[model samples]
Target: MVHETAAPASELVLEPFELSDDFYQRPHDAYDLLRARGAAHFVRFPDGGTGWLVTDYEAAKAVFLDPAVSKALKSPGAQAALGGDAGGAAMFGDMMLFYDPPEHTRLRALVNRAFSGRAVRELAPRITELADGLLAGLAEDAATEQDLLDRYAFPLPMLVICELLGVPNEDRDSFRAWSTTLVSNDETPEARGAAVSQFLGYIDGLIRAKQEAPADDLLSELISASEDGDRLSHRELISMVFLLLIAGFETTVNLISNAVAILLTDNGVRAALAADPGRMADFVEEALRFESPAGEGTFRYTTAPVTVGGIEIPAGQRVLVSMAAADRDPSRFDDPHRVDLDRADKNHLAFGYGVHRCVGAPLARMEGGVALTRLLAAYPDLVLATDTELSWRKSLIVRGLTALPVRLRP
Candidate 1:
């Protein structure tokens, strides 16, 4: 449904979009309106910069895979929107996220081994064991209410990521605070900047320790990669770790939380999976499509004028691929809002679309499958503590609940 034919960027008077209170409360409704209007909406982002928000699935997929769209977020407005950086590129360094082509290709290759299929396959037993341990503690309170995000969802992935990166368990508390603030859309730039500084500083010290005494861990491997024939600069090394730690667990945290919420709320989806444990993988995939954890993909800047879904967006403007909207676009899926675990199409853009698609998705799927299996096995009657509407966290990109209150037994 192209609302209008494409034209030059300067000749367009696009309808403005904003992140209103209604959007925060019922994002799907807002997305429905946007999709009905056109593929992309021209608007100012919360950070006070103008850009295009692509909610249509076809347009978003095209945007993600389009070479014309660069990963660089160099615009000063984008910087302010992403939470003003204290040291800019030098501080954040050459993050793989911001790189394109040869640079992105090279950096991703370096850390790819750490998350290889073989590596993750070997971690299966450990992951199961970790899930078992968490469930044991979670079961201690037989009938008491608990926030699944705090008790199960957050820790499971956080622990796995920390273990993979060789981060000390004692420092996880700090990571939780920093990560929450970092992903939050409500935090002030000053606060976000402080968190970034402290986070990188901690990583710096940890790297120093790993260098003095290398260990059998991903961080050690990354450090070695940096020192070896294919060298990684100090900034790149720190940024890689930062990217891994944040991307490694945060998305998974929301995935697990969102899935449980669905299982507790939707009887049909729950019953189908409960009847057949073999359907766990299918359930996880459907959950990703049904309730994408990462609301919007990482911001992108256009290098050249581009036309998407009947609208022309000029070069140098920011582009946001709204997975939250795209995943639910009615044109792409039949009854897009329903949780149809049996649906034939599982090709959702929840993780993302192209080279920049979340590299941790494999690990996330494996962990999510394990966590959901163990959770249901432990508490077959898991249900929300109250029948109230769950409060979603207000974040620029993070899609999760402020708290997922549930009881071990219904």
Candidate 2:
């Protein structure tokens, strides 16, 4: 769903404007400007699609509640509405992120078992062990200064997901490379395509192997996962694996990296968390709000004219709910910019809300908590590396540092 605009409709109170690429690099100021103008602002993507960008917390929560405000790219109109956005719904294959109700509902049901509270709780010891190994590696590296994202943040979740999904240790590097390429805006279209091709091809081969020799892993379980006698098809299995494989770790790596960056820079937060390691849950949640890893929620399309934040968007228009903006809305969060571990409101849209809320959230939170606890306990003097400028990943939907250079010792 998309509506092209050269000029604003009189009713469109917040004027439509094109967003700059730099917004990703420095977004809080832009978010403050938009949120002040109104709850919903009509914005145009650089790629030529026009739609509403929801900055108000209430408006964003409303959008999540409305099932008619769609997520599927199955329609040509929907695809056109998100024109030229490289990592559009297609990159995700036919996973839950791109689907609404029935399909999403079915997929969520079939996959929920893998990320249930009990399942994640069961994964805690292994997660702790993974974090310890990575931290030990970081400590032993030649340089005292290291890119935490490379040394620990990326590896913790990547290793956990790979192990859970049954990816062989030898092939984990290939998956990491392919994943990095697919989510990267710097990668050329051909490169991204090939990465997607290679990722799916590998998954295809793995699925066959799992079929012949099913193991005690999520992939094997997904192959047999069924909802009301509806089992996963070969394609669905691949998409589900792709979703789990990438989303399972990519978002988390960002969360870990972002959280660590916060812990290093925000002394009050770091001290509180360090004093009482149990406060890490609060630390992680606040970090998600202050700097959402998934800066923007997945692109949503309007199936019918829908009113959000007092703006009525016509049918067949794409809508982007900025979880990054919504999380920091002053109305919902007092002193939103501050990194307070004891904010009265514990709710945040970091994992999103409603039906499509990330099914893997419990697991991500556990991983984030474990990673931070392990690192801080090991390196109480960790600080951002001298002369380092944190580089945010260029992807529009992803909001995390490409590298988090830090000194393990003061």
lDDT tens digits, residue span 1-410, model 2: 22334555664544566677776677777788888878877786544446778888999999999866888887543755656352445556487778777888888898885554343457889999988887887766534777888878887888899888888867878978998887776778799889988999999999999999988788888887776888888888888898889889989999999988888778899888768888888888999899998888567887788897666787777788999999999998999999998897979998999998888888888889888888888888888885655778777677989788888887
Give the poorly placed runs of model 2, Cα more than 4 Å off.
1-15, 46-49, 76-93, 117-121
Candidate 1, residue 281: the lDDT equals 94
What would the per-residue lDDT of candidate 1 be over residues 1-410, giving only the tens digit for each residue? 12332566664556456656545556787678778878988865555555788999999999998887877555454454445541355655479988777788888787775555343557768888999899999777759998988999999999898988889988899999998898887888799889999999999888889989988788887877631468666788889999989888988999999999999889998899878989999999989988899988567777777899978887666788999889888888999888887889989998997888888888899999999999999999898997788988877577888899999976
> Residue 70 of model 2: what lDDT?
80
TM-score of each: 0.92, 0.92
**Candidate 2 RMSD to the correct structure:** 3.3
In candidate 1, position 346 carries an lDDT of 88
Report each candidate's C-alpha RMSD, comma-separated, in the order given: 3.8, 3.3
lDDT of 2 at 364: 89
- Would you list the clashing residue pairs of candidate 1? none
